[model samples]
Target: MSSEVVRFEASEEFARRMDAEDSLRSFREEFLFPVHDGEPAIYFVGNSLGLQPRKAKTYVLEALEDWEKLGVEGHFRGTRPWMPYHEMLTEQTARLVGAHPIEVVVMNTLSVNLHLMMVSFYQPTRERPKILMEAGAFPSDQYAVASQVRFHGYDPDKDILRLAPREGEETLRTEDILDTIERHGREIALVLLGNVNYLTGQAFDMAAITRAAHKQGCRVGFDLAHGAGNLQLSLHDDGPDFAVWCSYKYLNGGPGTLGGVFVHERHAHNKALPRFAGWWGHDKQTRFQMGPDFEPIPGAEGWLLSNPPIFQLAALRASLELFDRATMPALRRKSDRLTAYLEFLLDRLPPGVVRITTPRDPKQRGAQLSLRFSKDPRRLLEKLNSAGVHCDFRSPDIIRAAPAPLYNSFHDVYRFVGVLERHARD
Candidate 1:
């Protein structure tokens, strides 16, 4: 926390003043904002899908041109050679997650990488076959873990243990999570959790959880779908056995783009570890030989299944360049202030109208704030959308809004709250 005080007020003028003072404000011009009523809408849904960078089109077009100019030779002689295209993203991706270049790789989608990581890290013996995880995890994670357990000849109902929040609570307590790990230490083989809860916007202490799980002799991993570009994480220092994340969210890669993975350097050269083999995962020097013997590439690249997707990687590179110029430490500083300002404004709304489900503590969350409304939130969100507030709504009662540090402005948050307040009065 800086000594400089942030006194939030419920006025548009105050919002403009903050925006003027924000050093990162100019970066907002780089994105393509959604238009509503012939003006840029207040977009607060970066947690679901990020706004496209204006440079993405140019990058993709460059790749398209290279492919057209050079046919088969493009693999080795393109503007950015297709053969080693993913290598261009490795350093930036690693820096974003606080990992070494050898430990990070951009490959398959989130679910596919989760399954691939499980193949190597989730070995279960007769005595310790259970997998532990947070209850109410994203549906994709829940399904992936359950299906993996079933594939390994274990019943998901008996082998998968889900830790839930206490009755009447909206989020899990760190103490509770540790205590559960202690109590179930013997039967657990692996502990997998989403670093930031998608629905509640609660960020977990990954290092602490990893320490606790490792103490209990359990292998741990994270689904960083919401944490990757939103929070400052030290994946290598956190010491999880492996972690996976989608690039489409805060990473601002285009929709359904490729995902990222991190494997601890301790396992980087371990050839004995079991993994599903692929041509791309073969040793790069000998890969063209096409030998029948499976020679795994050391580190996270060993998990890749196919050649890189050039267009998607090109778009991702554009976003990464913006992030490089902005830098993580600065973005995180602005993110903390932006989310805090959102909480401040929401607290001033009429009593009992809406409740914030995400934690108030900066350490426990990222840029997103999930609101649980008193009435049917679906209708409320629809009304907000009609007013040009482009946030996301979950089933039943929650609305998730995120003021992305890279593009969103303080004025945007102010306008979103104003729409919600007017909708409540209506």
Candidate 2:
């Protein structure tokens, strides 16, 4: 091994032994490995930035080749024409999220789509203008909702209701969430929460929670940024009014790629909803008529504000193809086993220094486990980095490690644990 440094150590033999029996081990070959100073690093950060799929290069090159060969005609006439390009991705993405085709649209960035969905759905009234969300939400979402409240002429400090975990708890519980919804539903205009929390790998009960929120007449939406590729989420069956997710993370799309949105079909036909519109959202057939009368397509496409970034969508297509090959259910099975194995291995470590903050139940979390280190988390993360285990560190004290089923193996988890054990001892 070319060792610039060895901050922590794992037996290569154990790593290989685990890899030998891993059912998902072959998937590691499908991603382009990350190298530091010409040596491939152990990447455990799929929860943050997913490794590039092997097909990504081809997908992006095809788009570029089409652009070169067709010039301006590429918009409508080239191979995989830009027209209806997003549609090429929608069907597979819809399947992954368990949504109907008409209800899902692949477009826009995650936070932008959330804002767009809220623009139409979050109509605060005199008696019920407050919005409800979990505390410790991803920072971008917190900023978005706070800005949304201010934009609507409501004081966010007064109107934004945050549901925090009970005293001495690391994650929110289902019973508590239901209670909070019942208590604030009367005054709440909307409920928007993470499907799988980013900092803590907590997967909320979507169907039951949606029913509860709707019962109290509060509109509900989800920030599925961490949920989409990490779990088998059903946006349609679960009945959230809307949901949004980024493609870059577990979706394995390139960095800062465009994202997808789901607006339940019930709301798609409602032309009365307020929104920020653009020309691309106009009727496809009559769009070139150039008249100011905007007739929207009869689906989620109505909410789209602009033609998509072709290059970004190309990257997404590569990732989606891999998802199709592996399929969500099959991937979820591997995810459960992989995370369980990770947990089992972690359990073997001396407990007090590193306690798992994520739920023990398989159904309540995705492939990720948020391990909380009682000591200085940043310092631990630094040692982890120096050791070449690339899991992400969420601020204060959580290290979020995701054994992404698409490209991670049981051996990776095994190897990571060995390094972590050394870090703990030091």
Candidate 3:
């Protein structure tokens, strides 16, 4: 499953042959690609918002019909039983992230989940009252950590440590990160980071980072908004204290769908951990008793605040079913190849036009390849849009493209490169 450049060629015939050989080719038809100029789009932005699954409508409609027919009884009498609807997704979601059902739950959106996890995990003491995180984390993560520290009466400037890449470097080194953890060992109360950097598409070593943080007697958590479905995660084995992610990107759930959270099983029964409690988190047996005492359901379910939206869960379940069938291992095999093919073709473009910011090693990244150009990519992005190459432009000069293994093909990558090459030439 190595992405050896020697086996690649820069030709349409080569792309077509690769597509013909790809075992995942049929999955492409399972999604609905956007149309541009009366043709299917060359969609490569799955890292941002994945293409909608053709089955999403079917799933949504089922829930709608259930609601209409059963009314409030849908809670207990519907086909899937709305009262336990979130349970249907637990095992599958856990499998996707390599965790047990007891450790995973689908609940609030990504940021809210982050806040909930921190409430339990980020217990800053007077002796060790600092948070260490990568510099330039997504703004939402930055805001969450900043506000959390402020709520505890600590100044973010003094209490938050931002780890940046070395001078003249674009990505952080594992050694630098470890060294930072060691240097700030005593002061650090928590270590937080995005498992995969959204802008650069650089996937961090979560296991290594978690081990280092634990060695320093610090709690560690990760924002997996980009890494969840794109990377092969072993949350339980990796030993991160907690993790959070949204379902829209590589998970292919509809826009603004439910997010997920992971809590290490070790903390499952720690009733002393602080959390914002709600009725849904109460014990299932006593939840309807109108009891005065709040007894949380053990494990990740304890953090849930409200009954999940059935329709959103339905959409996500539709996408997760696809992942269950394709399986991460098989998807990773094609993802490596599709991304390698994309890299191969991008390399053939004229020099000094665009530079890859993502790590070159396949093991160090997922399906995305971020291109930094010499000038603003806005005009070129517009041209790509008109040409039916669906991708996105970040501020200033970077363009991000992800060849999602579930539905994207080598031909899509090839056509995308052809359009980008023409734009670069002009």
Q: Pairs clashing in candidate 3?
A: none
The regions of model 1 sitting more than 4 angstroms off are 1-3
lDDT of each: 0.92, 0.86, 0.89
Error of 1 at 134 (Å): 1.1
User: Where does candidate 3 have its weakest 10-residue lDDT segment?
Assistant: 1-10
Please write out the lDDT profile of model 1 over residues 190-301, one tens digit for every residue.
9999999999999999999999999999999999999999999899999999999998889899999999999999999999999998999999999998899988899999
TM-score on alpha carbons, each prediction: 0.98, 0.94, 0.98
Residue pairs in candidate 2 whose N, alpha carbon or C atoms collide under 3 angstroms: none
Superposed on all Cα atoms, the candidates' RMSDs to the truth, in angstroms, are 1.2, 5.0, 1.4
Model 3 residue 255 CA deviation (Å) reads 0.7
Stretches off by above 4 angstroms in model 3 are 1-6
lDDT: which candidate is best?
1
lDDT of 2 at 174: 94
Model 2: residues >4 Å from true position, as ranges?
1-24, 36-40
Task: Write out the backbone clash pairs for model 1.
Answer: none
